[model samples]
Target chain A: MSAPVVELVGLTRTFPGPPPVHALDGVDLVVRAGEYVSVVGPSGSGKSTLLHVLGLLDRPTGGDYLLDGVPTSTTSERHRARLRGGRIGFVFQQFHLLPHRSVLDNVLLATLYSGVPRAERVDRARAALERVGLDHRVDAAPTTLSGGERQRVAVARAVVTGPSLLLADEPTGNLDSVSSAAVMDLFDELHASGLTLVVITHDPVVSARAQRRVRISDGLLAEL
Target chain B: MRRRAAPVALEDVLELAEAETPPPPPPPRRRRWWGRPWRRGDGFDLRDLLAEGVASVGARPGRLALTMLGTVLGIASLVVTVGLAQTAAGQVGRQFDAVAATQVVVRPGSVLTQSGEERATGRLPWDAEERVERLAGVEDAGALAAVDLGGAPVTAVPVNDPSAPAAVSPPVVAASPGLLDAVRGRVVTGRSFDAGHDARADRVVVLGARAAERLGVGRVDRQPTVFLGEVPYTVIGVVDGVQRRTDLLDAVLVPLGTARADLGLAAPEELQVRIEVGAGPLVARQAPVALDPGSDDAFDVEAPPERSRAREAVQADLNATFLALGAVALLVGGLGIANVTLLSVLERRGEIGLRRAVGATRRQVAGQFLVESVVLGLLGGVVGASLGVLVVVGVSVVQAWTPVLDLPTAFGSALLGGLIGLVAGAYPAVKAATVEPITALRGGV
Candidate 1:
């Protein structure tokens, strides 16, 4: 690879109180272009913490975070959010589509946040929904969709912006095996379509689908 | 299939966005709707703000609708009350101005007996006119003598027709030319009093419009004859109408001298006086005493200037009353707005937090609330203004009154309504702006 898409050096996060609690300690990491990588750990091992920092949802307590080449550690909240909305697409363990919105509208919301023109959002949303085989379910409620379909809708929302990085915080965490395979298969298809995918899960079966696996323990990351 | 890789990270997007940013910056923020219109900024654009705000709020339609209702009603109430009060004030000013301004009346008689016997005389002597005319403070003074229709047995017979209905004129001194000036009449016929005519108590007369028209007496120089107490009188000029019902315009303006002789009203029924220029105090005291129209009272002194002053005082009092009523309406509007804002703040705790998390400053949040409040006030003002105008115009059309739509009054009412909304919205909007997002999102009120 010409250069890594993301590089984090000596990243540490500490929340202040009577005695400071360290959420992440002295971490160095690199994510190459279009690579499907999984970070898996038990609770409190900082897998989600690392994802938050990488996704621009939060700044590291101490670190140099270089994206492509420029720095994000010192950027304003506005810039950080702009970057997050434009570049990084996040999929939560829970399908977090706003409850009141239709599935198509939910997909359009991502486009709206990314600053698409008002009239273009619907067509873009439709095209995104079709990519996940949900074109016919355009006006359906997010709540009405089954576990697998809802997860797919969430995935559709994530990739709608054509974001380079797709962070999946346990894509099939809430699904049964049958539904899990459906979600995993969709991720495989997206990976083939040139999206850099990061799946965070403690499931060994989930980890097995990734091209490379990284284990996090006690705020430390190890390649497996 | 080849394993694809290339994470679109933050740096890549920022680089792209920096390059894509328009050079001239989208028409320089396109005129901010709130405060400073079209001032240059380092990217704090109201258009962008509105777009983001609408999207964020639109995400929750039920809550937004409920909040909008509260604001709209608050603003509307403000506008309507203010507009109505102003319309009423204008109506009062126009009608009252036509009649008098700060006016007072001075009737002459005290309460007296009705039996034909000359009881305790409730009278101002007809000759007392000289005394009133000479008063140093009095300006624009004139004396008028009246003849009671009840006491007279007069008949009118037009020369050409010879048998028309008797003109209902009692007989009056049409006095000096000053009498015409005193009651605001103009001689549209031959001429008014010359010295000789007034001094000799000439038997020449002027007919009021109705009397002249009825008697077929349109001539200016040809001497028309009318009988009064069996004596014949010559006609002189004509005027429009009687100013007071008790005093007849339809009556003749016989020379003041001739009227005294012809009517035998040496002891007059009432006296008319107008105070001197700027003699407000004298005239002011004169009117209430006069023009009372009741027999129990002494002779009523009808002082024009005083009556006008009293009318102005009455109008002022009415204006104050309307202002107080308007104030009460404003209070109600304010309370309603406050109640709504408080409820909105409480209901929208989570949403406020979300906007803050999305990068809105405290000022921006508070400002959004204020803008919403102002919009409510303006909307209400628009609706209320339309209703008020309709009422004013409708009244004018149906009742034959003129409408005076004063801009200051209209704007004043609207501004007051806006003030009510702003005051009511302030604390709640601030409280909403300052709410911490983490806890609000975690649990809502």
Candidate 2:
């Protein structure tokens, strides 16, 4: 269905040095539409590199990447950016929320690069916040939010554009156990609503919630 | 009346097949020159850029204000210099019109003979005033002679007291009776010599204000006598304020006939003519002809230029000096902007990385920083221009001058500040844009 939302074949990324570090080496992965998948690994296991490559933030040194059956390996930077803006959403471990912006404005910022029409951006952003259970705190600044609420706002921002695939890297890494559990529950609800989700984490509790699990070690991948 | 309603059918309510037609595609949106068509769902909005730019500027108000000081000083100096130059030019013009412009000097030309001796080629006739006065624009005319006394030093006191300070020999000049009016001289005390004194060659003399002070003869009522190379002449008047020949305020003036008769003075050396307003050119042209019809070429007439050329040259030099100073100030301001902007780029690496990760293009990141710098410069420009104009007005008011300011100078300074900001922002914006997202996310190199 939907030609499998994402497919990677023999993807490889290397950091140059006297002895180059192969952060991701010949990794192949595929996720069908609406699937909830977790890529789990310990530190220095290339989980972050895989997530970066998938989100189009970092280029793969070798491999083929397809999103919705469209080849992206040879796409120009401008085209890649357009695809990232319209078709993919990312959540970072740091939340990366702008301190100066209100919770609503942060959500609205998703439409800033997505080309959402000015008239509909506010309503769409509001609806996303509502889905993340943050409608009551729309006008509050991000500094005022608890860790759980901030992460939730970040989630709303990621989904505001209705991106086809959501990529989260260490989504619960900085949150308390209770807040992390709450954020994981929110992820489950979003997945149940038929949105494709990929989470990269070393935490067993976070990985256990995914419908399918994949393990990464020494730049290689295996299914569990 | 009975109305029969059609039975509501679930199939009729569901018209799902008709609903498949996508409601007339959301009204077409406009495209920005820089952005892709809105329907592409991939273009950033201009408003978004502006919002981010404003947010960044507001984030560091104190730093922004400090950075703005440089531009303000630069623009302020430029505007003030231009404004004052205009006002000073206006004052110089009025002074020129009042004195030099209305007065023309006509002097006899000398030719070097084959014998290697200088001889007067054309001498003003004894009736020079009458001839020149006949011209249409001549308001007043008079002849003057230096009346050389053969280098003989004359003193106020007849007794050669060796104990007295060294004798001062002020030059003696002889003038026609109407010279006072032609030269715009005012009688400070007593009276000037009349036609009777000139016709009879009377020994009456008018002491210039400075000359009277030099001779220690302050009052004409006392009838003090000044010995001009051993001939005593009665002091009839003390004159001051000679507008045309200000240097003559230090000379002793006697009747022309008296000087020629007693002091052995030759023919008059110069003809002084005052004309009606705007008659300088006409009188300058016709006066030489009126004085010597055949030897008109032998006389040289000096007329004021139409627009105060000498004063304008002085004004230009003043403006150049002040503008150079302004340029230095502006240069310093531009450097300040560059320094602060570079620092901002370094401090905001985290923000830059975040924006990049959120799908902003490199150009967009560069554009945001550029806009912020430009906004800073524009703000400084506005404040500086306003302050500069106010300073100009304030100084003019204190100096009793009319303020002069043009529109372009006022607005152009602001534009110049903006331009400076633009140039200053270039290196920093490039640095901000080139920071790799992965490195910036790690918060360091």
Candidate 3:
């Protein structure tokens, strides 16, 4: 009976040029509560553009994006950012952890711009690290961690805010097969605990782990 | 039985309901994750920004030190320059205070008292020096008059030779007995004419150093004699270091009685008085009264400045010149900050992208850079001011002067450094804020 966690209709994004390339054209998608969906596509198939629009990092030229039952097209950039920090979380392929901070500080960084209270931020960060099996590495720097452990730290940072939706862009692209499997298993654990997930990857093995899969080619989408 | 059952049922039913209730669905938006209300604009804490500023500044110690050098030089030079100007001014003031301030000159002036006819003027009495010497602060007093020795030129040799270049014509002056002490003159060789010589109307003279030279007289041991228009006078002494009436150094001095009896000298024209420090005004007002009780208005007294206005004037001029130089140096320091900040923004594109992606607004990004620059400037200002004060004290110690520095000027320079940093960082912070997140994520241009 609750509204869908994410809804996009007629989404269009264009890059201004002499030829005027359309990165996304009339894409429609719906993700309900607690669902795990994987968007699979080739290198130039507009997946990044779609992710950018969904993450509120870039606005679509024409479309409707409803996040948590609230239309985000008309919101100010500040309000959109608020929604991004409050309702959604991102895990990038590069892990993007600040090198100067400790693993624990890296996780706590998510609460810096989320309005989290000062007293409880460290405790919440610690609990999130424990969830991702990184409690032992709390004081260690991100540079000291292996690829798999670093990816796990990134996941902890993403879910530290208890967001309604988690978006992972190429989560296992830079990992070995074993590390990839470990990261996927961690995502499975997060999903089993009633968290919504959307993974964007070109790897078939990564897509196969999701409950449902969608494919995109040349800015158009098709259910698989 | 029914009443007892009802009372038992109330407690048991409450306990059963408490156990059956499912914990309320994880409280939504208002209490997201942290279980507290989310207030708008509370995302970034000032403390965090300050911490971030510290971390960024601490990252490259060498670069921070190098950037601070400009401001250090700017502030240090400013303090030293101002301090030295004041010290040098004080040094010049002391010299003036010794001679100009301690000596007072009184001369006769003609006054028209609203009458059509102009009165001749109050002549300095023959005993003017004795009368003025009675005043409290008068250290010594003397009088001098020009003798009208009819048109004949003075010469050391009475017999003129045709080959002589020209006849020397030094004027002759009638001086009182106390002229030596009042004028602070030191007789290099022979003794000066005393009261005994003046009482007997002796034809004695004291040759000034220059006059003695002009007359080919070097030593008073030979009792050199020079002729005043064929009236032979004995040179009793040769005096040097006569500060006031330096023109008298080139003239011959004769006793007042000798000039009066031989050259028809009527009365003294000028009176000179030497007083203690801080007594010029008092002596100036009392000298005329002592000389002629009721005719005080007829004498004009020349006194040095009451306060060291000349020193202040010199200091103000020096301050204006040096402060301009300091401003230029400070401006250069500001530009150095701007240059470093811009380069930092270019180098930290990845960090900027990450922060922007993590919901840091443009203003927040700009604020971080601004705070970093201000911290850099403040550090430089504080260190520079301390070092400047040390340099001033050191120079003062070496020069044997008391160090002078305005505390407010020192503190204002420190704050000005911060202001310079703020202004300098403005453009760079804006440039950093305008960086596109996606482009910056690509690791710069």
Candidate 4:
């Protein structure tokens, strides 16, 4: 197998409270290059917390996370943010698209913080939109798009920076069956072309599409 | 074909991504001199910060206008108060220059006698007018004295009616030929007595406008004569429009030599000198000395209290009073901007969180909001400055006075608005910068 794009060793996340809550307990995982991995869990199963730690949005209390061979546990917050922008991409269930912006602008904004050159941002955004099969909707506003189309635009924004790892949290939880299949087909096409993807969901049908599946429950993970 | 096309596009994007990756940091030897590494190509630049700020501010027009109102009023009032103060000071100085600023009066020095009565210590020289006229800055000089005509009732008719309802008698004043010119009085009708009249002691009298009206002598062309005591004097002229020494408009004036001979006037009591404006102090000092060269204490002089100093004092007083009021208004305006900007921060918390998530640093986020507030303040300042100029000009037009305003003051006031906005927006910008990215994620989820 190629070098691992993500390595988690003894990662633990604890939230401070009167009685502290452990969101991730001794989680260990590895996502190799060009791999499509699915994390399956129910509500409050620490799936989101694990995703947060993997995306460098939240720091783990103990142990190390190596993203693209760089140890991220001891990096500064600014360095982590830079890594998050240039190397990692996130797709949330709600899409998180700015309604007032044009579809093309939504994708171009991802390049603003990812070190993309100003002259090439438009071309990169257009190429990313074409890859998502939404090239015709570049001039349309996000508010004018359907739920599936908006999700496609969000995916385009996520991939516009050409991130090393793409993280999706319930990407199809709000979509219809037809739209869910369409997005899954897009993911399969991405994985076929050597992109690393980690999709978190509770639906077995969605998890089954991935080459590797991991089940998470009550802050612990078991590979299936 | 589709599978091959996907991989080729992915290879292109991956190649670009690899090329764009930042180089590894230099090996640690000593601590880096700069606190933050220069991330020039990575994060936000000045252009991006400004564009984001402008876009955010332009998103809401109504709120922007409401926030700017306070700054506008504050800046407008400040400009108006300062402009009007300068204009009014100029107007007052001009009016003062016309009359009071150009006059100097010299009177005989007095002493207490052994019997406890005030007596003139020294008499004015007989050629007092000619003596003082030679002094520099003395435009015109005249000698004057009140003639004591021993119970003689001066009247228009020669009939000495004892029971004619006790008519009030007009007083007689002895004056040199230059008195009318010195006092800035104009001859309303007829002519004034000349030097020849004084040399010949011709007994020609000039009637003040009020005195002529009381004596019922309107036309001097017919050679009207008025009786001073028992001697008849021809009324040669009626003098009016006396700017200085307005009391001269209500007296009957006779030639100084004629008063000395016929009315037995002892000595001239006072000298009136009309100097050029702003020459009061110099003329006052020199006139007293010129009147009595041997005795410095022979005369008391009163000059218009230092014209420029008095004008500056008045201007300073006006500026202080109005500027304080304008500052208070400006402070209130700044507070208003702060209040509204804070509200905007609170309202846009989610948006701010989203920006933070999308790779904007805390400084970048703060900078965006700061730029927004500054733009608002600057706009208000420009509008406010224009409004203030208009107000000053309008008031000047209504009052028929010249409007005075400094260009830099107007320009600086607008810049002050931008500065106020910066100060006002600081706390709110900090608050925005502190918003966590997790808020955006949690909110979306």
Task: Compute the interface RMSD for each candidate structure.
Answer: 12.8, 9.1, 5.4, 11.2
Which parts of model 3 are misplaced by more than 4 Å?
A101-105, A126-141, A178-182, A192-194, B1-41, B77-148, B152-170, B174-183, B187-239, B254-309, B315-328, B390-404
lDDT scores of the candidates, listed in order: 0.63, 0.84, 0.83, 0.85
Rank the candidate models, highest lDDT first: 4, 2, 3, 1
Task: For model 2, state the Cα shift of residue A117 in Å.
Answer: 2.2
Error of 4 at B442 (Å): 1.7
Q: What is the lDDT of candidate 2?
A: 0.84
Q: In model 1 chain B, where is the ten-residue run with the lowest total lDDT?
A: B32-41
Ranking according to DockQ, highest score first: 2, 4, 3, 1
Local accuracy of candidate 3 as per-residue lDDT tens digits, B281-347: 8898899999998888778888665645667877898889988988888888888889998998998
Residue A154 lDDT in candidate 3 = 86
Residues A1-81, candidate 1: write the lDDT tens digits.
Answer: 636777889999887897987878888888887688999899988877787778776679998888766699998866765
The DockQ leader among the candidates is 2
Clash pairs (backbone) in predicted model 2: none
* lDDT minimum window of 10 residues, candidate 3 chain A: A112-121
Minimal lDDT window, size 10, model 1 chain A: A112-121
User: Model 3 scores what on Cα lDDT?
Assistant: 0.83
Best by TM-score: 4
